[model samples]
Target chain A: MLIEMLIDLTLACGVVLLSCLSLSAQRVFTAIVLYVSLGLLTTMIWARLNAWDVAIAEAAIGAGLTGALLLVAWRRLCDETAAQPEA
Target chain B: MFTKLEFRKREANRRELPPFAVYALGFVVIVLSVALMFSVVVSGKAAPKLAGLAAEKLEASGVENPVTAVLLNFRSYDTLLEIAVLLIVAIAVLPARSSNAAGVAHFCSADKQDVLNPVLAALLRWLVPLAILVGGYLLWTGAYSPGGAFQAGAVIAGAGVALSLAGRHEFLWHTTAARIVINLGLFVFIAVALSNALLTGTTLQYPVDYAGMLILVVEIAATVSIAAILLLLFTELKAMVDAPREGRQ
Candidate 1:
């Protein structure tokens, strides 16, 4: 029970930190990275909840696929931004 | 009067709090309130009947892994729908032509030196294959263990990403073969579902003798497709990085 509580607390702290970072991050890439970390933390929390299926899905689709998509989109946007001359 | 104007300007220059501050605070309050409500009103063992039914049905699936049984048999339709959703998302979010060009060029030429540090590359080379092996083992033993197709696919995709980053394969991102590999999973899934519907009068239902074989085939296809999609995404990002700098004076 003590271990479980510790795990829960750690996950909660991770979620809060990631959320704050996501909000404060200036670059789109940094935000995407934080979001992925949040997804990973959520997966750990799901694992602790004994919802192994949810945990696997969260890790694979949530963190892995979603993060990749966001990064690609961000990179594309960055390129577009660079191509436009400064006003 | 000039001093008063200067002071007013200084006060105006001091930044105001962002408009999102109020929304953020409200969101936190809503979440906390919801948590409190759940704690107060939600009962323990809320769905005992459904849980009991699930437990009773588990033995008939012939899978030792409860999660696997739930995913592959009991809630297989949901799994199928989820895969479909992923495929649809991939299709919908495919980069526009300029975006695609930008991504590919970025990947093909961008400063590899910064991203591909020697130590990290060596570490990845050592770790990636081991990760693949573990993922495969987890997938193969999923019927009797905690892991399954998604976990294995993600692991394999990680290896693919590592390989791409290490520059192990030039055509990893930009090839007809890559596109085919990515689509293969959806194709295989659809084919199986259609065949099962024809053969068994139900989509995705397999003959008792061939259940394990069917699952293995699906898992392999899923792993390949996932890896391809991930690698393709990375390649697209690389293209973006290399694109704008090409024509600059």
Candidate 2:
């Protein structure tokens, strides 16, 4: 019962942190960081829920691959912005 | 003294900060405090029952590995759609122009030279094959082990990246072989699911005797597709790396 409560508390805190980060982050890189952290925390939630398969997929595809993709996109966007001149 | 004071005032006037910083800091502090409180106050004894339930139900699904059962049996349809989504994203995001054809000649001519030290090459010679063997073993044993399609695919892709970096294999940004491999997993997954539905009167339900074979086949296909996708992404990044050089030339 205590373990359950802890898991629930962790999940609730994770969700709140993720939401706050998502709303408060000013930069795209920071947003991606928050998103990936959220993914990791959600994976923990899934593990707590006894869904190890979903947890693994969440960690791998959700956090890892998606983070990579976002970073790549961020780099491309920054490059494009840097190449542009103020009129 | 008046001039110095004026200069100091000017410096202070120029040192402006964003107005949102204070609010953002306050928010962060609040969140951290909440997280601390939860961690301190919450206990850790409520998850075992769920784990036990999962163990019981998953074993009854005829899969020895609970994760495998969850991925391939309990939620097979989701896996099917996930592969489809991956294929769609790969197609939509990858550029139409063939980077392979454009850069192949340059890549081949640049350096046939071995860039690595002989000692590293010898070590990699042993390590690469061993890694491949382990990856294959992981895929084969996924039915009863912690290993699975994604983990094995990542391992194989890591080897591919290493080999390409070592100059053993040319980086092909877009190739027919790659395209085919990328789509083959989704194709096989859909076809198998459809066939199962048609023959068995239920979706994704293989014959009892053929369950292992079907799982293995799907895993192999997923592994290939995943490896192809990752390799392609890396090649695209490499193309970006060479873009500046090409511009200079």
Best by DockQ: 1
Task: Write candidate 2's Cα lDDT for B131-169 as tens digits.
Answer: 677668777777886678876766666566566656556
Candidate 2 error regions (>4 Å): A1-87, B1-18, B21-54, B99-117
Candidate 2 yields a Cα-based lDDT of: 0.70
Residues B143-164 of candidate 1: C-alpha lDDT, one tens digit per residue: 8877887878777776765665
RMSD of each: 8.5, 10.2
Off by over 4 Å in 1: A26-30, A64-86, B1-36, B92-124, B172-176
TM-score of 2: 0.63
lDDT of each model, Cα atoms only?
0.70, 0.70
Q: Candidate 2 at residue B95, lDDT?
A: 53
